[model samples]
Target chain A: MDADLHPERGMFLHRLNPVAKLLVFSCFILAATLYLDVAVPLTFLVLAWLMGWLGARISPFALLRRLSPVLAAAVGLTVFNTLFYGGPREHLILTLGPLSIWREGLQIGGSIGLRILCVASYSVLYMWTTEPSRLVASLMQQARMPYRLAYAVLAAYRFLPILQRELGHIQAAQQVRSAHRRQRGSWLRRITHYGIPLLVSGIRQAERLAIAMDARGFGALPTRTHYVRTHMRPLDYIFTATGLAACALVLFALGELGLLRSFLAGVAESLAGAPQ
Target chain B: MAQERLDLGLARWTTREIIVMAVISVALGLIFMAYGVLYLALVPLLGQVGIMLLLGFYYLTGILVPYIVRRPGAALVSSFLAAFTELLAGSPFGIAAVWAGLAQGAGAEVAFALRGWRDYRLPVLMGAAVLSGVFGYVYEYFLLSYAVLEPTVQLGLFLVRIPSAIVLAGWLGKVLGDGLARTGVLRGLAITRSAS
Candidate 1:
């Protein structure tokens, strides 16, 4: 994996305070939920992807490649929703035995799938731009979160790669041992034979980590100084304020249009008429 | 050098147990990631069928952790650890992973709490499954899925998840634990003693 995708790179978005980014993201999600329409959220996805290109300097191809899994999932979700969830005022697109594809269902599913894509894109941008360590430090400093807990989270994050590497080593060692024993069992048995050592090592690693942290007086201090501080710049303020304003404007437009309850009402009406 | 305490009866790990747990965690995490991808992929068509599967994960993690660590908060910690693993593996859920961790941990905690932190009987395990399932359902419905679902539909969905958690998640966890112990690797964790 490229180091740039490590969520710890010093990119434009990475420079913002973690707490500020978190709040902005949260507000964005809330606004998306409130709008209850596919268009706005889908727009957010496009905007986020664009920002990744312009602001973070991530290539468009790279961004899309990273988002392939989410895109594939959205397609699957849309299909499932259209077929099984028939509703009132639905335009029957397709039908099979007991399963009917409804227009209303497609709209609803598309809305949801788009919302997920938008939310996911925003997060990917955050992770891609921000360093995990900086994010954790900012959370502790700006949010007044407990340092012990924050550091614990950081520790866990850092430990993951180590664990993965160790797991690989253990597997190789097991394969060698199994070969010597001339193990002629099935794949499942081979897996069982190899798996036990990895688990034991993981537990031992955790214990050692805990002991090491304890020895360092990890939880002893009431407060600690950060080697690096996150100071929000004028640009961050402008970005966040603009993001919030955009959310508010979208919500206002949705409310004024009176389209908020239409989807849910349609769903309720369809569910009620369906033969049990 | 201090002589290491060696007890053959305790079933000391010989590089085998460590590998097994790591594989299990990875496999479980991968399965979860696949389900998560499916949940997101299917969302455009169905609301979230795999959402119910989350309850099973909570139940399984709760039982599996306690079976391994035999310590307070083992279930909770393990649940978070697993979620963290998934997130690191690039779960699309983003920060929602944190909330999932908390909910799943709480579910397992409830099960352990019901046992008075003493008993590990099947009934207690089942009770834990139910408790954890309910917690997960409430969180998902109220926090995540509430806006999408009507009030009655939300309640119905919640009700349906409980049984799925108990049967699919809880039962499978027990069986998996038994299988792990039979491998003789879990003997080191003292889970075998509890199994009998």
Candidate 2:
């Protein structure tokens, strides 16, 4: 819940329309997955850290801590692909017993690692900066999302924690009934006996909620007014254009300039055909 | 006009359906949160085959929603909304969680579409569930570029997921649907209406 987006209303990034930020960030991640080239995404990963402090007003240490899973996943992915999923065992780097790590494996694996880092950094920054309500408001205001669907989703978002608490209460009550006293098949037994009743009650609550919503004429109008309006400021346009242009120049266009794929491919080819 | 629209499939969601889907999504998002924890912990073991391991468990919304609602595109919308729930609740992967929701939901939708969105037979549910797994992995494979991996390894990844999908999305969906129907909790749903 803490990471779900906080609307503190500070900094240039926070002021930008959530829709613009979401769009730009999504475009950036899309570009990363497209290339699968190492240097490109790696550069963006570094840039994301810098942007955290300069643009988004996020601390560097906080950014790093939040993005640690991505870093771990990158390391784990590199190891897995390099050791397990890579090419025809060409250009051996290390060998243990029957397993051999090839140079091509390293190239592809490292590419995936860098891609993860780049995408994760962008995503972490975006989610950290944008508030969830702002996101929904923008969707409805900008994207013309139906108020009924959007509000329902928002109300449901508010309900998740309540449901978690309800689940906890149910578990405690069942534990008092000695549900966990029997160690054998406790979890499986609990899921059926506990989960169903919980869901049944949850649905009943939602049904009642729908009735309340109707009583208020929740979706009687085609266009409803917002108490918290989201307007696209000059800052939103500037941030989006600048962010996208930077990503394209650094991640995609620069990769084309260096011909990164062919260079890696050539290095791989040489290693594969290298003489013993 | 309202009842006619519902029958003709012109209307996608009624207010009641929206509430129901939202509620279902929150409940299932809890399940997703648990899986996400397991995933973060077991990534080493999951390795390249990480996606298939999630096939069976993740798409339960796809099956349950469509089975109960029987509305056009209910499966896809349900899965997506469920995923959005995970996002609002705070997903580690951020926006990719929503993209994943779309991918998995579409997977389940494919199976139901093949049956012309009419059948809720055991085989139909099972097929949808398994395909949801296939589609999820397929989406990630392309999205993450798994084409570079060995063909045999790719095949193995694809194969291991089928059984889980069958159990979770396919069989469990059917079982739970039957149970809910017996409890008369699914009263006024399209499936129940069609049956009675």
**Per-residue alpha-carbon lDDT of candidate 2 for residues A1-276, written as tens digits (9 for 90 to 100):** 022233445776676788898888777777667654576567667777787888777987888787776677789878876766444444778888977777877877888788777776776777777777888887777766666777788877777777778888888887898867673574445556666766766777777888899899876755566766776777778888998888767755676677455333433543464333
Q: Given candidate 1, what's the lDDT at residue A8?
A: 44
- What ranges in model 2 sit over 4 Å off? A1-8, A88-90, A181-183, A186-188, A256-259, A262-276, B1-12, B182-184, B194-196
- The ten-residue window of minimal lDDT in model 1 chain B covers B1-10
| lDDT, residue B81, model 2 | 81
Encode model 1's per-residue lDDT on A215-237: one tens digit a residue.
77654545555665665667778
Tell me how far the alpha carbon of residue A196 in candidate 2 is from the true structure, in angstroms, after superposition: 1.5
Docking class of 1: incorrect
How high a TM-score does candidate 2 get? 0.88
Instruction: Compute each candidate's TM-score over C-alphas.
Output: 0.72, 0.88
lDDT of each prediction vs. the true structure?
A: 0.60, 0.73
RMSD to true structure for each model, in Å: 8.2, 4.9
Docking class of 2: acceptable
